[model samples]
Every structure is written in structure tokens, then in C-alpha cells.
Target chain A: MQVYVDGIGILGPGFAGWPASRAVLAGEAPWPGGETEEPSAAILPPNERRRSSALVRWAMHVAEEAIRHADHDPRALATVFASSGGETGVLDQICRSLASPERVLSPTLFHHSVHNAAAGYWGIATGAQHSSTSLSCYDSSFGSGLLEAAAYAEVEQAPVLLVAYDLPPPPSLFPARPLTAGFAVALVLCDRPSRRNLARLKFHLEDVLRDAPDTLADPGIEALRGGNPAARALPLLTAIARRRSSGVRLDYFEEQCLSIEVSPCPP
Target chain B: MVAMTGKIMAPLWISHYTVVTALGRGLDSTFAALRARRSGLRPCDFEDAGLNTYIGRVEGLEDLPITGAELMPFDCRNNRLALLGLRQDGFEEAARAAARRYGAGRIAVILGTSTSGINETEHAYRDRDQDSGVLPAAFLTRYRYTHNTFSLAHFVRSYLGLRGPAAVISTACSSSAKVFASAARFLASGLCDAAIVGGVDSLCLTTLYGFSALDLSSAGPCCPWDEARDGLSLGEAAGFALLERIARTTDSGAVALYGYGESCDGYHMSHPHPEGLGAILAMRGALARAGIKPEAIDYINLHGTATPTNDRVEDLAVNSVFGTATPCSSTKGWTGHTLGAAGITEAVIALLCLTHGFLPETLNTTRPDPALAIRVLIENQERPLGRVLSNIFGFGGNNCSLIFGGL
Candidate 1:
């Protein structure tokens, strides 16, 4: 499948948006690593904004950035939100509540705990009635999400927004699944070529029985890519940032990967 | 901006399908229960959920743990339900047959679940050492397979020996219904030649307590569309359908997915739009995608969860789309609201109605709400059915509508 990347959004440690992360991705600036700042989803109503979890904020923050970069109405685009561990904080809270003698749960927290919370909040924030889906594939979440988005864009002939985000598991569950930090990335993919196209991606599944997925050249970026599932998009993002044709492989499962041939569109 | 996608979608053959719910295993038992108007619901007797509400719990899953050395890692209520569902109606055999016909590498496994194996995680947490605050070592290795949302697809793919793309949609109740749309798109995009689309959600304390917290659980068997309706009866179910892009539909029982539509409520996280705007859009979108008039539909499987608000709102949506002409009913009264699995469960029921010339009435509903304009059938309609529409709405305002027709 092939689709044109029209816009990009990214947020992680020491980076908040596409332009802010471009230098680091292009190998022109030092990797200044630090804790990620809390994203404020002011676009949501005040009540929802207050009720929003960190994961929801991270996903919406990047989704909003991508929509702005693409200069498109958010209401018109279908959306796909992907994550491995969804709403860790909420999960921890629910587990803790269940463990208690009373086993009483907060209604708001219970409702917010669904995997589509981010997509739901996005719809409310933007009044987007377009189709939206939330999905997961563990470490392969990014590749799976990208594949779904690209396929939707091509088959439906519509622009689609794909958001992949994951936050570190709560401390109680960290030992079982240790994630380094929170990371989120969004892409607006279109079936047709446009002046806004950053690159054209041709994707197909490849069987690499023994080979590992592609890794970033920069050590800091590589660590980020390895630490979080959503950060696995670093290599593809870097290739787009460099504006050079390249082949990038993303982990899809144990023995197979998603191979993408990236051809940069002329500026 | 995105373009409106209303063009007619190519129909995909439903080669085989199977379901495991409180009703029973596979098609024959489920059909028997539906015909006899026997609900699978009973008082909550699940593993110490201790809730007052009734539940549609599958029986005997405790002794039926996934025991294979390779599959033991995925031994959980959700996967057990999936195994039970897959082993029925020759679903697994049909999957293998499709793999043989299209190559295992060209068949995708896409499933939907709201809580995939989180029951095991809850147990693991309960076993946590107090002072050390560490989970049991034995449960750590199985965490990925049991707790992660993708475990459903992973286990299904591995069990079926398929090497194709796999994913798990987790958009609450609408998850499985949306899988049909995703599979259709993937097949159209040439990513996969065949697809396994289904969902499984097991009964757990999280949902029991969570819905109790939200005051959405009914103390009795749910009576959708009833004037005295209270709330939903929670249930657990697993269902699967083998889909292939083919025109071979000579069998009388064969049904094809004609169209699917998905949308967001953009209203509230838990509460649906008072006007059912998203529901209307989804229904209209499905009709547009099928390139059929609303009057063409013979039956409507309402997403009537038995909650007063949900039933009334869904009634308004149905009235807006198909009006009172089309007879509609909520099978949730039989299976309870199966959450993520509701989509495929109800979808399979809709297919059964298409194949068998009968429309199931709302099982426990005696009197339809007088305020609602849509026709809520209280008696089963025995007649030839051609096309049917199923609706599934989930938390976070996710809504999906799927249309199925006999070929």
C-alpha cells in the first residue's frame, strides 16, 4: 500500500512538537534528554480537560498538532489511536480499588478507562463525527496503526489521522512491564499527492525470520526507540526528516516486519 | 479534509462463523435457545464477583484451561472463551482451510476486545506480596499474553497458524463490529486475502464493579425496550467469522457483509448523545455504503442495552433512519450486553436471522416503551429475511453499524 504523509506530530522527552524535534531527528542538534512536560488538552471542555488522563492529553496534544500542521479541519478526518498499555494510571486505580475490601470504583475513572478514551475525547474536543478506531498490538502498535491508517487512506480515498501513544506503566505494574517514558506520534496520511506531502510511503510486510527491526543511528534516539513502542517510528521519522529516499523496517511481530520505502516529496 | 466514503463496498463472503455465549456453543444450541426464547442469563455466580445483578456467564471454563505447553501462557478466561468459540462449528477448521486456500501468510487475524485477559492480571495483582509489593513470578512471564489487549489476536493468529497481519481493536463495545470494516479495507488494499474477524470478552470484576459503579448493571435479566427497563445485564461471549473476498455464495445459509459504518459520538465518554447523532450518522453511512435505501432492510438489530437512556436514544436513532416500518429487536435480552463481544455476538445472531427465516424478539421485554417511535418487536417474527443491520455502541461514544445480507 502507498500513501502520502501530509503532516506529522510528535511529543516525547525534551521535545513537544514536529519542528522542535526536527533538529534532533535530522542529526543537527544534540539529544537533550529530560522528562516530558505534561500536555494540557485545553481543546477539551473544562470538565473533560480536568478528567482527562495523561495518556489522553498526550494523544490529543499530538493529534491537535498534526491537524494544525496539515491545515485541515479535524472534524473531517477519520482517526486511529493505537497503544500497547492504555491508561496505565486508570488501570492502576481500578486494580487498586478492586484489591480493596470494598472494591468500590470511581464511575468517572471507570468510564475513562476504555482504550478509546483518547479518541472519544478527541471527538468531543473537535466535534469530529468521522469514523474512529482504537487498536493495540503490543510492541508492534505503531506499525499496526500505521498500516491501518495507510490502508484506510488508500482504500477509502480519504485522509486519515493515526495517533500512537504509550506512557510508562504505573509504579505498581512497572516491574512486570518496564517502559522508560511516555511517547506519542501522529501522522496525517492522504491517498493523493499534495503540496503538503512530506514523503510518499510504500509499505508491505516482509519476513525477516532472524533479523531485528531497523534501529535509529543516533544512540539517544535509538534508546528512545527501544524504550517505548510508539518511539519505534523514529527511523521512519528520521528518514522523512532527512528528506532522503530510504527503506525502513518496523517491528510487526516476532518474525515479520512492515517494510516501507520512503521517497521524499519535493519541497 | 477527508472525503465522505459512501461508495458501495464489495461484499465479502462469510465462509464460516461460530460463537460461545451463555446460550451455548456454536450455532445449533444458540439457534435452539433463540427459538425457545430461553435466555442464558442467571444470577451472578462468576468467580466471586459478588454483584447483585444477573450475568450471562459461560459455564465450565474453570476446568477448561488452555493446557498445551505452547498455549498455556495464554490460559485466561478471555482466551479460554476464545478457544471454546473457535473449537465450535468447525471455525478453526474453516480457518485452516482458508489458510490452505490463500496461504497462511495471506490471512489476517483481527479481533476485538474491551478487556482481553485482564482477569488473569486481576488475579496476579491479588497475589502480590504485601511487603515487597511484587507480583507472583509465575504470572510475570504470562503478563504479555494475558494482560495486553493484543493477546486476543496474537493467540488467535498463533492458534490458527497464520503468519499474516494481526491486530486487536479495543474500542469498547464497537470493537468487533469495526473489525469487519478493517478487514474489508485490508482485503481491498491487498494486505490480506482472507481475514478472521471476531471478539471475546470474559466476565471480570472490573466490569462487574465498574458497571456497578456507573449504575448500569441490571439486577434481573435485561429487558431492552421495555417500559420498565432498568439497566443492562452484563455478559461474556466470544465469536468469530471467517471472511474472504469471493463471490461464491450459492449456499442458502451463506451470508455476506454488505457494508459497515463507524462514527464517534463527540458527546460524552459514558453517556450517548441525547439525539443519537452519531448513531444516526453510522446507520445512514452504512446504508449509503451499501448503496441501498433504508426501506431495503428487513430487520434491525438494535443496540438496546436495556438501560433506559440507551434504549430510548437508540429508538430515536432507529426511528430517524428506518422509521417504524422496519421491525427491530434487541437480542441482548438473551445474551445480556456482552460489551466488546456484543458486536460479533449480535452480528452472528443477525446472520442467523438471515439464514433462518425468523427475527428474534427482545427476549425479556414484555411491553415496548410507549414513548419510543421505532417498532420494538415483543414477539418473534417468523418470515423470510433478506438483509439485516446490527448496531453496536460502546463507551467513549464509539458507534458502529454493520449490514449483512443473504447472497
Candidate 2:
């Protein structure tokens, strides 16, 4: 199946926004080093702003950037939010509270720990009553969510926003699945081509053993992709930024991968 | 809400489905219990962390052994229930047959769960080392496949030895119901020929206490749509369904998935839209995709958590869409609120209604809310039905409605 990517949003260590990251992906600018500043999600109301967690802010940050870049009304597009381990910080807090003698938990923390917490915030932020789905597949979350969003856009013939984000678990659970830093990537996919299209992606499901994802030339970017599942889109993002057609294979499961051939479209 | 008015897609077949809830292990017991209107809920008796609420805890999970050597690492309550669910009614055999018919690489596994292996983590937290303050080595070793949300899919894929695209949707309560929509997309995209979709959520302290913290747990058996309804009774369940393209299936009595619609409330994180605006949109979307009218629906499996707000909002939505004529009931009273697994558990019930030809009564709901305009069935009515709609809504305003009918 073929889908058009009209816009992209990315956030990770050393990369604050899509424009800066696009420059880095294009090798036109030095890779920003060190921790990136997290967004406050000031767009949300004061009540929600106080409740918005790091993961929710990261999700909304990219989603807003992508929708803004695509110039698509957020309300008109369906959404798919994918994360490997959702809000492990909140999970750890709750687990600690549960194990503690108090056995009491903050209601806000309890609700935020849900897998769809970020998606909920997104709906409130944009008032997008369109279909929204939150899913996860461990390390293969990005590939699974992309396929879901792409297929939905194709079937419904409407624009769909695909947001994939993941933050490292707290120190307690970090050893189980460690990550270098937080990562998020968003793609505004449409069934039909538009003037704002960045590139056209043609996807096919291949029945083959999972292959290691392509590494970025920059060690900083490569480390991010290697550690976080959502950053797995870096290779494709690089290709799109370079305005070059490339084939990228994303891990799906044990013996299956989603192969996508990207063709850059003229601005 | 406007009707979908879009091109109707070909229907998908529900070739096989099974459920393991507080009721029983397989369809026979589950159906029998539902027919008897028996409540699976009992006073809370899970692990410590005291809370006075009824719970529908599945029996014998601790004793349920993971038989496969390869699946040992993924062994946990959730996966055990998933394995037990797969073993029931020869679901594994049917899945194997599907893999053979459509190559193992062509069948997808899409399951839903709110917290896959958090129970293992919770237990691990309790067993942390005294001085080190680190989780036990055994826990770390088991964490890879056991604690991950995708572990359910991973375990199922490995157990069946299938290599198809697999994913786990985790939108809290509506997780499993949305998997049907995901499976349909895979089929439509030609990504997979047959898909194994369902949900498995085991009881854990996190959910129990979390719901208690939210004050959404009911002290008594949940009575959805009841005038005295208070809150939901938490439950643990594992439900699976095999979906195949209608053109490829020749199985008799296979229930057809006519349409599915998903939407977000854009209203609130925990609370549903007061008037169920999202619910109406989803129901309308499903009917539009199915190319059917609201009056055509025979019954609705309401997402009645029995919470005052939930039942009231859902009633408003159903009344606005299907009006007061169509019968609707909340099976949650029978199985308790299964969270992520509620979607498939209830979907299975809707399908069973097609086979058994009886509209299940809203168990435990003695006095229906008089203010509600929709028909809330209190008695199991014998009625031959053709089409049914199952609604599953979750936190984050995630709402999904599925239409199932006789082929």
C-alpha cells in the first residue's frame, strides 16, 4: 500500500524540534549535543497543564508540530499513538505507593499511568473527536503503529496522524529495558498527494527474519534510534530530509518486517 | 452525528472465539453461566492492599502451568490466562489450521491488555533486595517477555509458531474491541490473510488500587443501568477470536463482522462525554460502514461499567442512536468489568447471542433507571437476532463500536 507523508515531527535528546532535527538529518547542521529541553505543553489549560506528564508533553509537542507543518486541521484527521512502555514513571510511582505501607495513590497519577493517557491529552488539546487509537508492541511499536495509521488512512481515504513516543523507564525498571533517552516521531499521512507532501511511502509486508535497523551516520542520532523504538524512524527521516528515495526495513515481529520504499516528492 | 455514508467494505468472519472469565474456562461454561444469569463477582479476595469491592477474579491462574518450554520465560498470570484461553475449544488447533491454510507468516496476532505483566512487576517490587534495593535477578530475567505489554502477542505468536505482524492495543477498557478494527485494517491492506485478535488482562494491584483510588469500584456486584448502580466491579479475563476474510471461509454459522468504528471523545481523560457524543459518532460510523440503519440493529452490548456517569452517558447515546425500541444490556454484570479484555469478552457474548438466539438480560440490574429512554433488558428474552452491535469505550475518551451479524 502507498501513502503520502505530508509532514514529520521529531523530538529526542539534543534535538528540540523538527526543523532542527531535519537539518541534522540532512547533515546541514551540527548535531545538537546533550539533553533537550522538554516542552511544558503550555497549550493545554492550566488544570490539564498541571496534570500533563513528560510523556504527554512529548506526544503533544510532536503532534502539534506535525499538524502545524501539514497545515491540516487536527479535528479532521484520525490519530494513532504508539508507545512501548507507557508512563513507566507513573507506573513506578504507583507501584511504590502500592508497596508502601500507606497503600494510597494519587488519583491523577493513577489515571496518568493508563496507556492511553497521552492520547487523551491529545484529544483535549486539539478537540479532535476523530478516531484515535493507542497501541504498543515492545520494540516494534513504531512499525506496528505506522502500519495501523497507514492502513486506516488508506481504508478511510483520510489523513491520519501517527505519533510514536517512548521515554526510558525509571531507574528501578531501567535495567530490564534501558534507553538512552526519550524519543518521539510523528508523521502526517494522507491517502492522496498534496502540495505539502514531503515524500510518498510505498509499504509491503515481507515474511523474513527481523533485520537490524539502519544506523545514522552521527553517533548521537544512532544511539537514540538504537535505544528508543520510536527513534527507529531516523533512517527514513534522514532519507526524506535528503530528498532521496530509499528503502528501509522496520522490525515488526520475529520473522516479519515492514519494508517501505520512500520517494521524495517535489515541493 | 452524521452516518458514515462511505463505501461499505466486505464483511470479515469470526470463525472461532473463546472466553475465560470469572464465569468459567470455555464457551460452554461461559454461555451456561450467562444463560443462567449467574454473577461471577465475589467480595474482593485478591492479594493484600485492602479495598472493599467485588471482583471477578479468574480461578486457578497460579496453578495454570505454561506447558511450552519456549514460553516458560513469558510465564505470568496474563500469559497463562492467554495460554489457557488458547487451549480452550481447540482455539490453538484452529489457529494452527489457519496458519497452514494461510502461511504462518500471513496470519497476524492482535491482542489487547491494559497492563500485560504489571502483576509480575508488582510482585517483583515486593520482593526487592533488602540492601541493594534492586529487583530480584529472577524478576529481571523474566521481565523481558513477561512485563511488556506486547508480551501477550509475543507469547501467542511463539506458541502458535506464527511469524505474522503482531501488535497489542492498550487503550484501557476498549483495547480488545479496537483490535477487531486493527485486524480489519490488516485484512484490507493485504498485510495479513487471517488475524487472531482478542484481549487478555490479569488482575493486578495496580488496577485494583487504581480503580479504588478513583473511587470507581463497586462494593457489590456491578448492576449496570440499575437505578441504584454505583460503580464497576473489576474483573480479569482472556478472550480470543479468529477473523478470516469472508471469501476464504466456508465455515457454517460463522458470525460476520459487518462494520467497526473508532473515535475519541476529546472530552476528558477519565470521564466520558456527558451526552456520549463520541459514543454516538462511533455507533453511527459503524452502522454507516455496515450499510445498515440504526433500526436494523437487534441488540447492543452496552459498555455499561455500571458507574453512574458511564451508564447514564451510554444510555443517552444509545437512546439518541437506536431509540428506545432496540434492546440493550450490559454483560459486565455477568463477567464484571474486564478492562482491556471487556471488548472481546463482550464481543464473544454478542456472537453467542447469534448462535443461542437469546438476548442476554442485564444481570444484577433489578430496577432499571427510569430516567433512561433506552430499553434495558432485565430478563433473558428468547429472540432470534440477525445483527448485533457491541460498544467498548476506554479511558482517554477512546470509544469503539463493532457490528456483528449472521453470515
Best-matching candidate per DockQ: 2
lDDT (C-alpha) at residue B360 in model 1? 93
Off by over 4 Å in 1: A205-211, B1-3, B247-250
TM-score (chain A only) of candidate 2: 0.94
Q: How far out, in Å, is residue B88 in model 2?
A: 0.7
Q: Across residues A14-70, which tens digit of lDDT does each residue of candidate 2 receive?
A: 677778888888899998778868776665777887778889888888888899899
For candidate 1, write residues A65-108 as lDDT tens digits: 89889988888899999999788789888888888788989999
In model 1 chain B, which range of ten residues has the least summed lDDT?
A: B245-254
Candidate that would win on lDDT: 1
**CA RMSD of each candidate after superposition:** 1.6, 1.6
* Residue-by-residue lDDT tens digits, candidate 2, B30-129: 9999888888999999977588899999999989878667778998999999999999998999999999999988898999999998998988887888
Q: How many residue pairs clash in each candidate?
A: 0, 0
Candidate 2's iRMSD: 1.8
- Each candidate structure's TM-score, on Cα atoms with residue i matched to residue i, is 0.98, 0.97
Looking at candidate 2 chain B, the ten consecutive residues that score lowest on lDDT are B1-10
